[model samples]
Target: KEILLLLVADMKAEYIPPREDVIMQNESPDELYIIVSGEVEMLESEMENEQTVWTFKSGDMIGEVGAFCCRPQSYTYRTKTLSQLLKIRTSNLIEAMKTRQEDNIIMIKNFLQHHKKLKGLRLGDLLHGVGGDYGDPNMYVNLLTVASTGNAT
Candidate 1:
Protein backbone atom coordinates (compact mmCIF):
# COMPACT_ATOMS: atom_id res chain seq x y z
CA LYS A 1 0.00 0.00 0.00
CA GLU A 2 2.94 2.32 0.46
CA ILE A 3 3.73 2.22 -3.22
CA LEU A 4 0.12 2.79 -4.19
CA LEU A 5 -0.21 5.65 -1.75
CA LEU A 6 2.94 7.22 -3.08
CA LEU A 7 1.81 6.75 -6.66
CA VAL A 8 -1.69 8.07 -5.98
CA ALA A 9 -0.21 11.11 -4.33
CA ASP A 10 1.57 11.97 -7.57
CA MET A 11 -1.08 10.64 -9.93
CA LYS A 12 -3.64 12.76 -11.74
CA ALA A 13 -7.31 11.86 -11.52
CA GLU A 14 -9.26 12.64 -14.67
CA TYR A 15 -12.82 12.17 -15.82
CA ILE A 16 -12.65 10.74 -19.30
CA PRO A 17 -15.63 10.63 -21.61
CA PRO A 18 -16.53 7.76 -23.88
CA ARG A 19 -14.43 6.97 -26.96
CA GLU A 20 -11.44 8.96 -25.75
CA ASP A 21 -8.11 7.42 -26.55
CA VAL A 22 -5.78 7.23 -23.55
CA ILE A 23 -2.96 5.49 -25.40
CA MET A 24 -2.54 4.77 -29.07
CA GLN A 25 -0.97 1.81 -30.78
CA ASN A 26 2.72 2.05 -31.70
CA GLU A 27 3.09 5.26 -29.69
CA SER A 28 5.83 5.77 -27.15
CA PRO A 29 4.10 4.83 -23.91
CA ASP A 30 5.22 7.22 -21.20
CA GLU A 31 2.36 6.95 -18.75
CA LEU A 32 0.17 4.28 -17.19
CA TYR A 33 -3.53 4.67 -16.58
CA ILE A 34 -5.41 3.03 -13.76
CA ILE A 35 -9.12 2.64 -14.23
CA VAL A 36 -10.70 4.07 -11.15
CA SER A 37 -14.31 3.79 -12.29
CA GLY A 38 -16.07 2.76 -15.49
CA GLU A 39 -14.52 0.78 -18.34
CA VAL A 40 -11.68 0.82 -20.83
CA GLU A 41 -10.73 -1.30 -23.81
CA MET A 42 -7.32 -2.57 -24.87
CA LEU A 43 -7.17 -3.11 -28.60
CA GLU A 44 -4.32 -4.39 -30.70
CA SER A 45 -3.98 -4.33 -34.45
CA GLU A 46 -4.01 -7.55 -36.42
CA MET A 47 -1.02 -9.80 -35.90
CA GLU A 48 -0.73 -13.21 -37.50
CA ASN A 49 -4.39 -13.21 -38.49
CA GLU A 50 -5.39 -12.59 -34.88
CA GLN A 51 -6.22 -9.37 -33.14
CA THR A 52 -6.62 -9.04 -29.36
CA VAL A 53 -9.06 -6.79 -27.57
CA TRP A 54 -9.95 -6.69 -23.89
CA THR A 55 -12.52 -4.88 -21.79
CA PHE A 56 -11.18 -3.71 -18.49
CA LYS A 57 -13.02 -2.15 -15.60
CA SER A 58 -12.09 -0.37 -12.40
CA GLY A 59 -8.94 -1.60 -10.58
CA ASP A 60 -7.25 -2.45 -13.85
CA MET A 61 -3.97 -0.81 -14.85
CA ILE A 62 -3.17 -0.46 -18.53
CA GLY A 63 0.01 0.36 -20.46
CA GLU A 64 2.46 -0.66 -17.75
CA VAL A 65 4.46 -2.82 -20.15
CA GLY A 66 5.28 -0.01 -22.51
CA ALA A 67 5.45 2.56 -19.76
CA PHE A 68 7.98 0.68 -17.62
CA CYS A 69 9.92 -0.91 -20.49
CA CYS A 70 9.80 2.20 -22.72
CA ARG A 71 8.64 0.12 -25.64
CA PRO A 72 6.20 1.05 -28.36
CA GLN A 73 2.65 0.53 -27.12
CA SER A 74 1.41 -2.86 -28.21
CA TYR A 75 -2.21 -1.89 -27.75
CA THR A 76 -4.38 1.18 -27.67
CA TYR A 77 -6.55 2.08 -24.69
CA ARG A 78 -9.86 3.91 -24.95
CA THR A 79 -12.46 4.81 -22.41
CA LYS A 80 -15.85 3.26 -22.92
CA THR A 81 -17.81 5.40 -20.51
CA LEU A 82 -17.50 8.43 -18.26
CA SER A 83 -14.56 6.79 -16.60
CA GLN A 84 -12.45 8.04 -13.75
CA LEU A 85 -8.81 7.21 -14.50
CA LEU A 86 -5.73 7.73 -12.41
CA LYS A 87 -2.88 8.75 -14.67
CA ILE A 88 0.74 8.64 -13.59
CA ARG A 89 3.86 9.14 -15.63
CA THR A 90 6.33 6.26 -15.69
CA SER A 91 8.98 8.47 -14.11
CA ASN A 92 6.70 9.26 -11.18
CA LEU A 93 5.82 5.61 -10.57
CA ILE A 94 9.46 4.67 -10.73
CA GLU A 95 10.28 7.43 -8.30
CA ALA A 96 7.59 6.16 -5.98
CA MET A 97 9.02 2.65 -6.11
CA LYS A 98 12.53 3.97 -5.52
CA THR A 99 12.02 5.26 -2.00
CA ARG A 100 14.82 5.01 0.58
CA GLN A 101 15.88 1.38 0.65
CA GLU A 102 18.01 0.86 3.76
CA ASP A 103 15.07 1.00 6.14
CA ASN A 104 12.55 -0.95 4.06
CA ILE A 105 11.95 -2.43 0.65
CA ILE A 106 8.96 -1.82 -1.60
CA MET A 107 6.83 -4.33 -3.42
CA ILE A 108 4.24 -3.37 -6.00
CA LYS A 109 2.16 -6.48 -6.34
CA ASN A 110 -0.68 -6.83 -8.83
CA PHE A 111 0.25 -3.53 -10.43
CA LEU A 112 -0.72 -5.13 -13.71
CA GLN A 113 -3.57 -7.27 -12.42
CA HIS A 114 -5.92 -7.94 -15.30
CA HIS A 115 -9.33 -9.49 -14.66
CA LYS A 116 -9.04 -12.54 -16.86
CA LYS A 117 -12.61 -13.42 -15.88
CA LEU A 118 -13.77 -10.18 -17.45
CA LYS A 119 -15.06 -11.10 -20.84
CA GLY A 120 -12.70 -11.07 -23.78
CA LEU A 121 -13.61 -9.31 -27.00
CA ARG A 122 -11.59 -11.32 -29.48
CA LEU A 123 -9.77 -14.58 -30.25
CA GLY A 124 -13.01 -16.53 -30.43
CA ASP A 125 -14.13 -15.02 -27.13
CA LEU A 126 -11.19 -16.49 -25.26
CA LEU A 127 -9.62 -14.66 -22.33
CA HIS A 128 -6.36 -13.78 -24.05
CA GLY A 129 -4.98 -10.78 -22.27
CA VAL A 130 -2.19 -10.30 -19.69
CA GLY A 131 -0.85 -13.66 -20.87
CA GLY A 132 1.75 -11.89 -23.00
CA ASP A 133 -1.06 -10.56 -25.23
CA TYR A 134 -0.17 -12.99 -27.99
CA GLY A 135 -3.86 -13.69 -28.77
CA ASP A 136 -3.08 -17.32 -29.42
CA PRO A 137 -4.61 -20.07 -27.30
CA ASN A 138 -1.94 -22.55 -28.27
CA MET A 139 0.72 -20.14 -27.13
CA TYR A 140 -0.91 -19.71 -23.74
CA VAL A 141 -1.49 -23.45 -23.43
CA ASN A 142 2.12 -24.11 -24.27
CA LEU A 143 3.23 -21.65 -21.63
CA LEU A 144 1.00 -23.30 -19.06
CA THR A 145 2.26 -26.70 -20.13
CA VAL A 146 5.86 -25.69 -19.81
CA ALA A 147 5.15 -23.98 -16.53
CA SER A 148 3.49 -27.04 -15.03
CA THR A 149 5.48 -29.85 -16.62
CA GLY A 150 8.86 -28.09 -16.49
CA ASN A 151 9.39 -28.99 -20.12
CA ALA A 152 8.34 -27.61 -23.49
CA THR A 153 6.24 -29.84 -25.73
Candidate 2:
Protein backbone atom coordinates (compact mmCIF):
# COMPACT_ATOMS: atom_id res chain seq x y z
CA LYS A 1 0.00 0.00 0.00
CA GLU A 2 1.43 3.39 -1.00
CA ILE A 3 0.21 5.13 2.15
CA LEU A 4 1.77 2.46 4.33
CA LEU A 5 5.06 2.81 2.53
CA LEU A 6 5.04 6.56 2.82
CA LEU A 7 4.26 6.45 6.53
CA VAL A 8 6.86 3.76 7.10
CA ALA A 9 9.47 5.91 5.39
CA ASP A 10 8.81 8.52 8.03
CA MET A 11 9.47 6.07 10.86
CA LYS A 12 12.37 4.22 12.47
CA ALA A 13 12.62 0.58 11.50
CA GLU A 14 13.18 -2.35 13.80
CA TYR A 15 13.24 -6.13 13.60
CA ILE A 16 11.64 -8.10 16.41
CA PRO A 17 11.86 -11.78 17.10
CA PRO A 18 8.81 -13.97 17.43
CA ARG A 19 6.86 -13.80 20.68
CA GLU A 20 8.38 -10.49 21.66
CA ASP A 21 6.11 -8.22 23.66
CA VAL A 22 6.07 -4.77 22.17
CA ILE A 23 3.61 -2.63 24.17
CA MET A 24 2.07 -3.07 27.58
CA GLN A 25 -1.50 -2.16 28.40
CA ASN A 26 -1.94 1.22 30.16
CA GLU A 27 1.65 2.21 29.43
CA SER A 28 1.99 5.76 28.26
CA PRO A 29 3.76 6.19 24.92
CA ASP A 30 2.95 8.29 21.91
CA GLU A 31 4.08 6.40 18.84
CA LEU A 32 2.54 4.77 15.83
CA TYR A 33 3.91 1.52 14.47
CA ILE A 34 3.49 0.21 10.97
CA ILE A 35 3.87 -3.47 10.35
CA VAL A 36 6.40 -3.96 7.58
CA SER A 37 6.43 -7.75 7.92
CA GLY A 38 5.05 -10.59 10.05
CA GLU A 39 2.21 -10.28 12.52
CA VAL A 40 1.23 -8.55 15.77
CA GLU A 41 -1.41 -9.20 18.40
CA MET A 42 -3.35 -6.46 20.14
CA LEU A 43 -4.46 -7.31 23.64
CA GLU A 44 -6.36 -5.86 26.57
CA SER A 45 -5.63 -6.24 30.24
CA GLU A 46 -7.96 -6.01 33.22
CA MET A 47 -7.28 -6.66 36.86
CA GLU A 48 -3.95 -8.30 36.12
CA ASN A 49 -5.43 -10.28 33.25
CA GLU A 50 -4.70 -10.08 29.53
CA GLN A 51 -6.98 -10.81 26.59
CA THR A 52 -6.32 -10.80 22.86
CA VAL A 53 -8.23 -8.15 20.96
CA TRP A 54 -7.05 -8.60 17.37
CA THR A 55 -4.24 -9.79 15.15
CA PHE A 56 -2.60 -7.43 12.69
CA LYS A 57 -0.66 -8.42 9.61
CA SER A 58 1.75 -6.69 7.31
CA GLY A 59 0.87 -3.18 6.12
CA ASP A 60 -1.49 -2.68 9.04
CA MET A 61 -1.30 0.56 11.03
CA ILE A 62 -1.22 0.35 14.82
CA GLY A 63 -1.42 2.89 17.67
CA GLU A 64 -3.02 5.68 15.68
CA VAL A 65 -4.96 7.23 18.58
CA GLY A 66 -2.17 6.84 21.08
CA ALA A 67 0.13 8.59 18.65
CA PHE A 68 -2.31 11.34 17.80
CA CYS A 69 -3.57 12.06 21.32
CA CYS A 70 -0.27 11.63 23.13
CA ARG A 71 -1.97 9.29 25.61
CA PRO A 72 -1.17 6.08 27.35
CA GLN A 73 -1.51 2.95 25.23
CA SER A 74 -4.90 1.39 25.95
CA TYR A 75 -3.89 -2.00 24.65
CA THR A 76 -0.89 -4.28 24.69
CA TYR A 77 0.88 -5.25 21.47
CA ARG A 78 2.89 -8.42 21.07
CA THR A 79 4.76 -10.00 18.21
CA LYS A 80 2.98 -13.08 16.94
CA THR A 81 5.90 -13.95 14.71
CA LEU A 82 9.22 -12.52 13.60
CA SER A 83 8.17 -8.96 12.91
CA GLN A 84 9.67 -5.96 11.22
CA LEU A 85 8.12 -2.58 12.06
CA LEU A 86 8.51 1.08 11.30
CA LYS A 87 7.93 3.20 14.37
CA ILE A 88 6.77 6.77 13.85
CA ARG A 89 7.11 9.12 16.76
CA THR A 90 3.96 11.07 17.69
CA SER A 91 5.55 14.44 17.07
CA ASN A 92 6.49 13.47 13.52
CA LEU A 93 3.01 12.15 12.79
CA ILE A 94 1.41 15.28 14.17
CA GLU A 95 3.59 17.35 11.85
CA ALA A 96 2.74 15.10 8.93
CA MET A 97 -0.98 15.38 9.69
CA LYS A 98 -0.68 19.13 9.78
CA THR A 99 0.96 19.13 6.36
CA ARG A 100 -1.72 16.79 5.03
CA GLN A 101 -4.91 18.27 6.41
CA GLU A 102 -7.09 16.85 3.66
CA ASP A 103 -5.92 13.33 4.35
CA ASN A 104 -6.46 13.82 8.05
CA ILE A 105 -9.96 15.11 7.47
CA ILE A 106 -10.91 12.18 5.27
CA MET A 107 -9.43 9.71 7.70
CA ILE A 108 -11.29 11.23 10.62
CA LYS A 109 -14.55 11.20 8.71
CA ASN A 110 -14.19 7.57 7.80
CA PHE A 111 -13.16 6.67 11.29
CA LEU A 112 -16.20 8.41 12.74
CA GLN A 113 -18.58 6.63 10.41
CA HIS A 114 -17.01 3.30 11.10
CA HIS A 115 -17.06 3.89 14.83
CA LYS A 116 -20.71 4.89 14.76
CA LYS A 117 -21.65 1.82 12.80
CA LEU A 118 -19.67 -0.36 15.14
CA LYS A 119 -21.62 1.15 18.02
CA GLY A 120 -24.89 0.02 16.35
CA LEU A 121 -25.90 3.43 15.02
CA ARG A 122 -28.05 3.04 11.93
CA LEU A 123 -26.64 4.32 8.64
CA GLY A 124 -29.89 6.13 7.97
CA ASP A 125 -29.68 7.97 11.27
CA LEU A 126 -26.08 8.84 10.72
CA LEU A 127 -26.99 10.49 7.44
CA HIS A 128 -30.23 12.00 8.72
CA GLY A 129 -28.70 15.33 9.73
CA VAL A 130 -27.22 15.78 6.25
CA GLY A 131 -30.47 14.78 4.44
CA GLY A 132 -28.78 13.11 1.50
CA ASP A 133 -28.38 9.69 -0.09
CA TYR A 134 -25.96 7.50 1.78
CA GLY A 135 -23.01 6.66 -0.41
CA ASP A 136 -19.30 7.36 -0.74
CA PRO A 137 -19.85 10.66 -2.55
CA ASN A 138 -22.49 11.70 -0.05
CA MET A 139 -20.22 10.75 2.78
CA TYR A 140 -17.55 13.12 1.46
CA VAL A 141 -20.12 15.86 1.02
CA ASN A 142 -21.31 15.34 4.58
CA LEU A 143 -17.74 15.44 5.79
CA LEU A 144 -17.18 18.70 3.94
CA THR A 145 -20.38 20.16 5.28
CA VAL A 146 -19.46 19.20 8.81
CA ALA A 147 -15.99 20.62 8.33
CA SER A 148 -17.43 23.90 7.01
CA THR A 149 -19.75 24.06 10.01
CA GLY A 150 -16.77 23.84 12.37
CA ASN A 151 -18.13 20.56 13.65
CA ALA A 152 -16.21 17.50 12.55
CA THR A 153 -18.69 14.61 12.20
Best by lDDT: 2
TM-score of each: 0.64, 0.64
In order, candidate lDDTs are 0.64, 0.64
lDDT of 1 at 110: 32
Model 1, residue 120: distance off in Å is 7.5
Those runs of model 2 whose alpha carbons end farther than 4 Å from true positions after fitting are: 1-9, 107-153
After TM-score superposition, the amount by which residue 78's alpha carbon in candidate 1 deviates from its true location, in angstroms, is 1.0
- Return the TM-score for candidate 2, rounded to 2 decimals: 0.64
lDDT of 1 at 92: 85
Off by over 4 Å in 1: 46-52, 100-108, 112-153
- Superposition error at 71 for model 2 (Å): 2.4
RMSD of each: 7.2, 9.4
Per-residue alpha-carbon lDDT of candidate 2 for residues 18-79, written as tens digits (9 for 90 to 100): 88888766566667788999999977668888777677789776666455434456577899
